[model samples]
Target: MKKQIMLAVSLALAGLSAPAFADGSGFIRVEAGRADVDIRADGIGNGSDDDTAFGVRGGYWFNPNIAVEGFYSRYYSASYNDGFDTYDVKLHGVGVGLVAKKNFGGNHTGFFVGGRAGVARGVATVEFDGSLEDAEASSAKPYFGVSAGYDFSETFGLSVNYDRLKSGGDGVDVTAETLTLGAELRF
Candidate 1:
C-alpha cells in the first residue's frame, strides 16, 4: 500500500508539466540525519535500552511552503541488558507530511516549516543466555514534526528537525523524540 502510494505520487510528479523555471516553484528534495527513540511502557517495566537511529525524508514542493513528502526511519542497537541476560529491540516506520515555506521570492535562500502524518511499526526480542525469545509490534500511527533551514543555492542546503513518534503494537507501546542535522538535495 505504501509502495503503491509512493509510486502513484511519483507518476503524478513525472507527469506534472514542469512549472516555469521560477524561484518559487516545484522541486524534489532528499534528506538523511541522526535519530533516537524514546520507549514508553505500561507493563514492560524499566528493563529496556535504546540506541541511535537513522532516517531519510523526501519531499516535492508545489510552492515554497506546501508540498507532499514521505519518510522512512530505523533505530539501531536498542535493547536491554539484564544482570546476566540481554534483550533486543528494533523500530521502523514510514510517514507522509506537508512542507510549507514563508518565502516566495525566486531566491536561493529561505526558511521553511510544515507537518506530517503516517503509520509506524516496531519489533523486539529477548536474548537470554544463548536462546532467543520472540516479541513483535506493529501499528498504524500518525506522526508530526517541525523543520527550519537555509538554502545554499537552487539545489543545495541544510536543515534541522525534531519529531515525536507515538506507536503501539503487540504488547509493546513506545514513543520517541529525535533531533536531526541533515543535508538537502533539491531537484
Candidate 2:
C-alpha cells in the first residue's frame, strides 16, 4: 500500500513537471523544524513528545495563485521505558496536495500567505525494546497547513509553516503538530 501511494505521487509529480519547466515555475523546498508529538495507546502511558523533524517538497505552479505539490516528512519518533519493558515508535507520511497563495504586494516577490490541503498516507512503526517484536500500521488521512513567507526574489524565498498530521493503527494512535523554517528555490 505504501509503495502504491508513493508510486502514484511520483508519477503525478513527474507528469506535472513538464509544464512547469516550460513556464519556469517549478519549485523544490527543504525544511527543518521541531515536532510536538502525542501518543495514546491501550496499555501505555505518554512519554516524551517532542523531536526534530524535516521534510522535502516539490511542486509545479499551475498559475501565480495556485499549485499542486508533493511532500515527504518524518514527523516524530519516541520511546517509552517502563520498569520491565520498553516501547519505541516512529511516524512519517507522504502526500500530494493543492496550495492557494496570495502575495501581499501583487507580485511573486515579497510577503505571501498560503493554505494547503491534501490526503496523506501516514505510517506508524512500533517496536519492543527487549524483544525482536515490531508492528506496522498505516492509514490514509487528511492533512492541512498554513504558511507565511518572504520571497526575496522570484527564484529564492523563505517561509514558516505549521502543519497538522495524524496516523494510527491497532491500539496505538499518533498525532503531531510541526513548526518549520523552510527555504524554497524555483527553477
Candidate 3:
C-alpha cells in the first residue's frame, strides 16, 4: 500500500515537470513540526503524548486560488507510561487533498490563507514494554487543515499549518494533531 502511494506521487511529480505545466503551477513542500497524539483503548487508560513529525508534499495549482496535493507524513514514536507498563505508538500516512487559497494581492507572491480537506490511509502501530504483544491497525480517515503563509517570491514560500488526522481499528482509537512549519518551492 505504501509503495503504491509512493508510485502515484512520483508519477504526479513527473507529470508536473513537463514543460506545458511549468508556468509556476507546480510545487513541492517540506514540513517539520510537532504532533500531539491521543490514544484510547478498550481496557487501558487513555494516553497522550507529543512528538516530532515531518512530511513532504507535491502539488499543482489549477489556478491562483485552487490546487490539488499529495502528501506523505510520519509522526515519530510517542511513548506513554502508565504506573506499571509503557506503550509506544507510531503513525504514518499518505493522502491526497484539495487546497483553496486567497492571495493578498491576487498574485502568487504575498500573504495567503488556505484550507485543505482530504482522506488519508493512516497506519498505527503500538508496542508494549512488557509481555503484551504488539499490535498494528490501518484505516482510511478524513483529514482537514488550515494554513497561513507568506510567499517571498513566486518560487519560494513559508507557511504554518494545523492539521487533524485520525486512525483506529479493533479496540484502539488514535487522534493526531500537528502544528507544522513548511518551506515550499514552486516551479
Candidate 4:
C-alpha cells in the first residue's frame, strides 16, 4: 500500500511539473492548527484523539511553479488507559519535500499539490501502576497533500492544507493527520 501510494504520487508530480510563469519566490511560513492522532497496539485499545498542533516551514521556489521545502511539526499528546495500565504519547516530526505549484489569476493566487517523503520519530512513554517505561521509534514515510492561497501583497499570504504522516514500529503504530492554517512571507 505504501509503495503504491508513493508511486502514484511520483507519477502525478512528473505529470504536473510543466513550466509556469517562473518567478523564483522564496518564503518562510508558520502554521497552527489541530492534529488527529491514532495509536494502535497489539492487546491494547487504540488511542485516538484530536489535539493542538503547529509547524514551521521554509521553502525556495525555483520557478513560479516549483519549490523545495522543509518543515517541522509538533503534535499534541494523547493518553490511553485500558483498565490496567495507562500510557502517554507525544509525537514530533521533521521532513523535506518538493512542492510543485503554479501561479494563476495574476501572480500570487493559485492552488498547489505536492508529495513528501521523509522520516518521523515517535516517543511513547508508558506508565504501569506507578512505574514508567519509555520507547522510541523512527521510520521513513511518504505523504501527499494540497493547498490553495492568495498573496495579500507581494510579501504576505495565508494558506491552509491537510498533511498526513504514516509511521509504525517498536510495538506501536501511529497515523497523524493534521489540518493547518498558516501565514507566509515571501522575499
Candidate 5:
C-alpha cells in the first residue's frame, strides 16, 4: 500500500516536470571552482579546508524549452592544517540534473530551474601534526542540488547551483555551493 502510494507520487512529479519544460535545446559545459568542508565535531583535523574542483556538464531537450542535464565533478586535492593534526581529503561526485526554461518575449534569452540527484565518495586521511592520533575513513553518500540558468545565445549560458549531501558518517556533514557557465546546441 505505502509502496504503491510512493510510486504514484514519483510518477506524478515526473509527469509534471516534462510538460513544464516540454521543449528544450541540448548543451555541453565545463566549470571550475573551489569548495570547503566544515567539520562540526572534535577530531584530528576538524576545520575548514580549501580545495579545487572541475567538471563537465551537458543537457538534452525534450522539445524546445525543456531538457535534462548531468554533471561529473571531481575535487583535485584538498587538505587542512590544524594545530594538532594535518588532514587530507579526496572527493568525487556525479549527478543527473534537470531544468526547464523558456523565453517570455522576443528577447532571444530565457530562464530555467532544475534539480539534480547523485552520489558522492570521500576519502579522508589524517596525520598527527601535534599530539592527535592519526586515522582514515571512507564514505559513500547521496546528494541533491537545484540550479537556475539563462541563455545568452543558442550556444551559451550561465547558471548558479547549491547542493546538500548528508550521509551520516565520519562524524561530520558536508555540503557546498557551485557556480557554472554553460553552452548548448539546438536540433
Candidate 6:
C-alpha cells in the first residue's frame, strides 16, 4: 500500500506541467542523529530516554514552493532504569508527505517545513528480577518538522532538521524526537 501510494504520487508528479519556478530536480536526503523516547504505562513508571536515530528521504519539487517526499526512519533503542527495574524500547516508521518551502537569500538558500503521516511499530521490553517480558504495538501517526539548508551550486546542498514522531500503544505511550544533519543531492 505504501509503495502503491508512492508510485502514484511519482507518476502524478511526472505528469504535471512544470511551474515557472520549478527546479525540475529530484533529491535524495540521508540523515542521522539522536532520538529520544518518552514512555508512559499504567503499571510501569514514566521515563524519558535517548538513543541514536536515522532517516532517508527522496523527493521532487513540483516547483520552488511545493514538493512531495517519501521517507523511512529508524529510531534506535532507548533504555531506562527506574531504580529496581529496567526497560528497553525501540521504534521505526515509514511515511510520505508534502513540503512547503520558501527560497530566499541567493540561489534559493532558505528553509522548509513539512508534515508526514504513516505507520509506526514500537517494541518494548522489561526486565525485573532477572526475568524478561516484552510487548509490542503498531499505530498510524503524524510527524512534523522544519529544516534549513543552503543550495550550493545547483545539484548539492546540506541541511539540518528536527522531527518528532508521535507513537504509542494501549498502555504505553512513546514519542520519538530527533535532530538530523543531512546531505541532499539533486539530479
Which scores higher on TM-score, 4 or 5?
4
TM-scores for every candidate against the unseen true structure: 0.71, 0.83, 0.80, 0.73, 0.57, 0.73
The Cα error of candidate 5 at residue 10, in Å, is: 16
Quick one: RMSD of model 6?
Answer: 4.5
RMSD per prediction, one decimal?
4.2, 2.9, 3.7, 6.3, 6.6, 4.5
Which scores better on lDDT, 5 or 6?
6
Q: Per-model C-alpha lDDT, please? A: 0.61, 0.84, 0.85, 0.69, 0.56, 0.70
Q: Which portions of model 1 show Cα errors greater than 4 Å?
A: 1-36, 46-50, 104-108, 119-129
* TM-score attained by model 4: 0.73
* Model 1 pairs whose backbones collide: 23-106, 38-176, 65-99, 65-100, 65-101
- lDDT at residue 116 of model 5 (Cα atoms): 66
Per-residue lDDT of 55 in model 5? 75
- Name the best candidate (by TM-score): 2
Model 5 agreement with the true structure over 1-187: per-residue lDDT tens digits? 4355446545854776655554555677677766555554447554556566667767676654555666667643555676655666555555554555655424546775656654444444445555457655545555666667776665666666555543225575445444444344454
Candidate 2 global lDDT: 0.84
Model 3 segments more than 4 A misplaced: 1-24, 79-88, 128-133
lDDT of 3 by residue, 95-144 (tens): 98888988795457889999999778788987999866998988778899
Residue 145 of model 3 has an lDDT of 94
lDDT of 6 by residue, 29-79 (tens): 899988887777779789887788898988776665666788888886656
Error of 4 at 69 (Å): 0.9
How many steric overlaps are in each model, in order?
5, 0, 0, 1, 9, 0
Give the higher-lDDT candidate: 3 or 5: 3
